[model samples]
Target: SQGEGPDPYDEILQAFKIMDTEENGFLTLADLKQICESVNLNFSNKIIQEMIEEADNTGDGKISLTEFTSIMCQTGRFKYCAPK
Candidate 1:
């Protein structure tokens, strides 16, 4: 559709990797804070913590790719259709 550009799922994974600065395979509070600031968003710590909690499905205070994908699907930002 977009002239053979990268898959949408790959794009999402790439974005997650970029945000995971710690290279620990998950997103922590500090990573979120740094990205927010880089994008000129001055979110308070409470707001950031809330964001983490919202997506941290495992309740481990960090967001893994599975958690991120679940949130995206819940928010209608991503939809997965199995091959027919």
Candidate 2:
């Protein structure tokens, strides 16, 4: 049963992989913008700024998987972008 189930983390990892083009385990602001656009979740500047402040745990301008997951989960619901 375990192997038959679709991986829950797959959705989250797929979303991250979409944005992390460089495969550097981090995402730039532009990558974030692209993701938001894909999901039709246009965030206000205030919200985006708040996300960086709250989720950028490492103090790097780039967002790591942990930070991204925390932010995504905090958004009321997880929004997986439809693959293009």
The sequence of per-residue lDDT tens digits that candidate 2 reaches over residues 1-84 is 377566655767888898887788988766767678788999875676666677789888778988888777766454443232
**RMSD vs true structure, all candidates:** 3.2, 6.5
CA-lDDT, candidates in order = 0.84, 0.74
TM-score of 2: 0.63
In candidate 2, how many Å is residue 66 off?
Answer: 1.2
User: Could you tally the backbone clashes for each prediction?
Assistant: 0, 0
Highest TM-score, which number? 1
Model 1: weakest 10-residue lDDT segment is 75-84
Give the lDDT of residue 70 in candidate 1. Answer: 71
lDDT of 1 by residue, 4-83 (tens): 66666775688789999998999999999999999999999899999999998789999999987777667665434223
Model 2 ranges with Cα > 4 A deviation: 37-50, 76-84
Work out candidate 1's RMSD over C-alphas.
3.2
Q: Which stretches of candidate 1 lie over 4 Å from their true place?
A: 1-5, 79-84
Clash pairs (backbone) in predicted model 2: none
